[model samples]
Target: MLDWLYDIVGRILVWIHTGLTFIGFDTDSGWAWGLSIVLLTVLMRLLMVPLFVKQMNTQRKMQDIQPKIMKLRERYKHDKERLQRESMKLYQESGTNPIMGCLPLLLQMPVFFSLFSVLRSVAEGNARYGFDEELVESARAALIFEAPIAAQFNSSPEELLELGASDPIMAKVIIAIACVLMGTTTFLTMRQSIKRSISQMPDNPMMQTQKIMMYMAPLFGLFGLMMPVGVLVYWVTSNVWTMGQQHFLYRNQPVAGAAQTKNEGNGSAKGMLSRKKVAETTPEPKEQPKIERKQPKKQSRAKRTGGGSR
Candidate 1:
């Protein structure tokens, strides 16, 4: 199913590699291919900038409305259906979809897997996806940091030898260093987010789960042992991008603005409820019938005098 995607990712990677070569980098150098991977990451991220911006906006909207969301949960604690309807209505009013904040990130998962597959295929000398024999030879022979781009710490010595790692220990050590870099970047990327999450909503239902996951998250670096140095480069570079992006986009947050939001329950929910109550209880004006009275006529006096005489 993802074969087409892998092909596309492969082509993009080699395209970047070719560009690097045109600029005088040795095509057969591992550093050239490593730089190619780095450029590919930058290009992909640039292309996804709009989606990332949308994701950032979506999360901001969610946080802005979170207080109301909590209140909804409280009010409809027993009526699951009511809670759901009201929640959807609230999201609609705010022009927000809490689910969207994660969609952009989730959409990126396929690209990662595809790139990993492409790099793995390169190690196996499969050139059909996006390379010719010459390119395959160049990439396989290329070494950056004294390790093939396809080096993996967990690969057996024979496997490393097959991948053209002249010194298996050196390759293993390089791969380990890349893994540590990936883990450290991953943790740093999560730090600001964890801090903001706790500050914005100390009582968030997910707070504990988030905290637990934040520490556990970096352990994913351990999995780097099984990945090619190429993919590790990509992962670390991507995390660095995320950190910069987050810092720029959320520079003014978790402080003055959040303090106001926390005190106001974000204002949207409370204000919405206030408006609804006012509309429901306020009476509409009804027009009353108009009345006009005129003085009695002189004829009434004559009529009273005639009756007295009779």
Candidate 2:
């Protein structure tokens, strides 16, 4: 089923490699393969942008409906099935699929495996996974600097030592640096994601999952040690792209909670300023004068009445 997919990805890589060769990058230089992988990463990420946008929109919708979800949860606390039904209904009504959040990442998985298969075939000096014989040979000879583009740290230490001897420490240094970079970028990307989530919904249950990812993501760099430096380069470039994409989304279309909070804050500030202006512009009320009544008025009226009677 996926053979076609592999062929497509392999052809793209071959095309990139060939283009670089024509541009003065030696067919045997690892830099050619490394840059090709980076280009591939960029292209894949660009293609996924629409899906990422949908994912962000779905996430925003989910956040917007969180209060409703909580109410449903409370109302159906004793009815698990009904709770789920109601939740699904709510999502349907809102045109949101929580699973959409994973769509972009899920789509990348096949591409990752395809690339891995292509690179592995190249490493084995085989024309499998859709590469022609000529392309295979070129890929086999491609060096990433001092190490072959297909070189894996899992290769025997003695073999690496020999390769290092030929390159004067360049191979080991490049692989180590690539691994560290891949790891650091992964960590930073996840951290930014978590930070954005927290800003939007500090009490979100999903934050626990994000927190766990924060600790686990950097460990992927360690896994990079077993992968080819070319693959590590791809991973690092993808991470960088994700970081930048996430930053842009967070800044522009922020999650519902964050957006609402910001709007409310602005409203509160405006209210305060208006109240202060009114206080400053309005005049104070004037004090009333005190009035004294005459005590002799009753006696004068009584004397006048007595003289009239006489």
Candidate 3:
């Protein structure tokens, strides 16, 4: 099933690429290819924009219902199945699905892989047999940005095979930089998403998994440099787009459940605390002592004693 999905996605990518190539967008210039990728990324995201918006709204709604969910968890503490069913019930009533928020991200992976695959195949092709050999050669060279890194390495994998590892310092450095950018952007994007979601989730095994994903994705992306510079470019561009899209989504309509509620609560608490501090710091008025009829009090005892003696 997974293979079938991948094959279908790959075909879709090829169709898009073919269309772009026919339109003179994907050409020998690296700039054209880069722009095409960017446009394609934007188009794909735009096509799913409605779904993404729905996902964000659902996430916010889920967050809003978290307190109730937590109460349910406490109520069903001993019965895992009951907890699960109750949770589903809560989501159903709220019309929010936690899983839906993940769909856009999950769908992006196949598209990303397809683009990388196309770039890799083109970059790996030999130009010896075609009438338009020069164009293919130009396309291959253009696939790898003429960065100092690409200029320094054996431009061909065949060259890489023949060259000693110690000999290609410049190429290695360039590749390393590309990999680092790809990984860093990916890590940053994941970090932002997780940071946004953390307040909504309890400290539990799931949070641990989120932490792992935040770190591991970038680490995994760092390996992309070994494939080809073109692939690295695609990965890097994709990461950048992901980050940009997320930022746009968050700024426009941030997920609101735990984080926003906590923030509002904290603000209110702070206001209360401030009022208390003012009350504490404010000085109180001192009271004056009242005078009594001291003479009457003193004379009564002495006069009474004298009268009794007389």
Best by lDDT: 1
Q: What is the lDDT, from 0 to 100, of the residue 113 in candidate 1? A: 94
Model 2 regions lying over 4 Å from their true place:
157-165, 260-310
TM-score of each: 0.80, 0.81, 0.65
Spell out the clash pairs found in candidate 3: 63-257
Q: Rank the candidates by TM-score, best first.
A: 2, 1, 3
| Model 1 residue pairs with clashes | 30-142, 30-143
Ranking by lDDT: 1, 2, 3
Could you give candidate 3's per-residue lDDT for residues 124-192 as a string of tens digits? Answer: 553322213554454454433333212223355445433222334555666678878888888898898
Model 2, CA-based lDDT: 0.81
For model 2, how many clashes? 2
Give the Cα-based TM-score of candidate 3 against the true structure. 0.65
Per-residue CA lDDT of model 1 for 1-310, tens digit only, reads 8899899999988898998899999989987899899888888888887887787677677777889999999899999999999999999999998777677678778878988998888888888568888898888887878778876788898888877888989989998988999988988878877786666557778888877878887798899988988999999999999888778867744444666767688587889999999999999779998888887665776576787464
Q: What's each prediction's clash count?
A: 2, 2, 1
